[model samples]
Target: METQLGNGPAGIRGDLSATDLAKALRQGWRDFAARPQYGLFFASFYVAVGIGLYYLFMVRGETRWLIAAVAGFPLFAPFAAVGLYEVSRRLEQGLPMGWTHVLGALRGRGDEQLLLMGGIIFVGFSFWVIIAHMIFAIFASAAGLGEGMAFLTSQMGLTMLAVGGAIGAIIAFIFYAMTVMSLPMLVDRDVDFITAIITSFKALSANFAVLLLWAVMIAVALFAAILPYFLGLLVVLPVLGHATWHLYRRTVG
Candidate 1:
């Protein structure tokens, strides 16, 4: 059965244009420039964690951990974005920015709505990890593949990658539809997480074409950013994070 939309602080969803994507990027760049300190500060956390994960998996030769990290990291990205939402909110409202305010936004009024959203992200990530492991086991076992670099070169490994990538894309789209506006909505209003998610989904359905393009742009940009040992995320994460706020603003009215 289809679930009904929640009675939250709903708004009319605006039609998104390709030009709006460009405008959002420009505005996001402006926000980052106006407050590079906050952008850099928040970005540093993501870079540090990413680098730490790299060192653990690459340097320490913990490939299993790397698999889990790679599978799960994107799920947590929306939560990390709360900081950027706060920055954009402050910028839009002409509110004063500071360490106290930015950090306090992370506290989120001790709101359980954020916690509920977080739990959903966690569960989604956990499910992906399990599925990834299963795919690996099944394909590798069938092809008599061994661990380390050998599996990567084997036919089984290629098949696993193809299948996993397809599944991961589906999962990513689901999460994106649920979160593309929900997090910012939660931060900007008093709505519950369920309502925010439903609203986000509605917005996506209303403008699936343009929003899908935006999603593709985000994925490509992020992939390019991470290729540089995660250092690029110091900039890419902030820009995209802020842009996401602008996107949410335009989409949700």
Candidate 2:
């Protein structure tokens, strides 16, 4: 089945389906494979962050904080892909993919739209962290636990997971709906962040099922990639990042 072709608020978007997703994945792989260096360059940043998190978890012993921080990666990951988006965009448009051009993804067309979108994501993520900490405090105090994650396997831990995860997922999904299209759109076009966000919402509304599937795929892949000390992100993040750009191109223009 397909989302019926129609006019979107942004005058982009069309029929979206499983086939479109597969094609976008293929395109994403193609883009990354063709220019693995750029993908590697951008993904390295995540690898570094992940390594830093691992250090904090093992050395600094910030287990609870690490848990919350790890959960917040998805919120931050999309913006990191802006550079990947630039790479994918350049490849799609047949433009020169040089360091100066690709590295300047933040400056995107001399407009601040990308940065504005980033600010929205940052603020949302910060609030999410605060809520996560509060939830942790409540759960930890009631359970009488310390910084260690020993309670994670207990009944109270399970309950806290359920409550915190549900709340975290809702907040994450709201931001996902906002950024899924807008970030790429901001990179490809010079539109304001608000317009891009509205268009992103409309795109998600029109292709709810397919987009949801993609989101699940990304989340699963990211979590899996984290298992190997974040080294796996070198491959997963770039491939997924490029795939996201192609997905945006197909569904959101």
Candidate 3:
């Protein structure tokens, strides 16, 4: 027999079964609205820490922006896991969320999963950085040549600009395909890392348009969140985070 929705291994088993996209979307919002305080608490913590770091960096000028970006990963690592744990706790217990419950979920497998996910994140990030630098180097070298095909192309830099954009788009798609469902799948199941990644890629490929929509939405949310030193994330983060869980449910559960 097919498993009952929430009782299944990994909080999901088969393909997307729900047909009401609008209803599913509404449910995601409603689930988050039902407990706004918990959402605010989780997001506030992120904002506070993020702001504190930003202030320190601005005032001290001790680290360049690039160095700050690299150095800050470990500090924000716990919040990343906290976000996942919040989703898992709600999935497993159906309990009304609280800050304490969020923290509790972060214990045990929470940390392990975070570490594993972090490793995956680091590898992907490094790959993107390398590719980006290579792109920059190629364009910079071309621009340095004084007069010739190099100068002609450099004068109408649109070609290089188009190439850069194409490269970025391809990389973004790959990144999304690899990670779209992997974390939730990991939280919901005992699947090995390789399987989770493969499944995530499959989900991304299968639902390319919808996943791209989701990806764009996330980017917008993040931009708004950080625009005001993360205060906006107090609303955007939980809504998007919870909705993401629901999206995973629809696509893979």
- RMSD to native for every prediction? 4.1, 2.9, 6.8
Instruction: Give a tens-digit lDDT track for model 3, residues 1-253.
Output: 5343432344343334334234545655675677677667777877787778677766765332322243222223223534543654475467666566566554435447645765767676566556654654566566775323443356534455466557655765565666667766666666665777787876665656556766676665576667786788787777666666667766675
Output the number of the TM-score-best candidate. Answer: 2
Displacement of residue 149 (Cα, Å) in model 1 is: 2.1
Please give, for residues 1-253, the per-residue lDDT of candidate 2 as tens digits. 3333455444556458889889988888898999999989888988898789778777987666777888887798889899999998888788987999988987767777887778888999889888888888788789987657687777788788899899988998898899898888888887888988988898998888889988888888889999888888999889888988998888865
How many clashing residue pairs, candidate 2? Answer: 0
lDDT (Cα atoms) of all candidates against the true structure: 0.82, 0.84, 0.58
C-alpha RMSD in Å of predicted model 3 compared with the true structure: 6.8
Judged by lDDT against the true structure, how good is candidate 2?
0.84
Runs with alpha carbons beyond 4 Å of true place in candidate 1? 1-10
Give the worst 10-residue stretch by lDDT in candidate 1: 1-10
lDDT of 3: 0.58
Residue 124 Cα positional deviation in candidate 1, in Å, after optimal superposition: 1.4
User: Each model's TM-score, in the order given?
Assistant: 0.91, 0.93, 0.64
- Scored against the true structure, residue 14 in model 1 reaches a CA lDDT of 48
Better of 2 and 3 by lDDT: 2
Residue 251 in model 3: shift from native, Å? 1.1
Per-residue error for 85 in candidate 2, Å, reads 1.3
Steric collisions counted per model: 0, 0, 1
Worst 10 residues of 2 by lDDT: 1-10
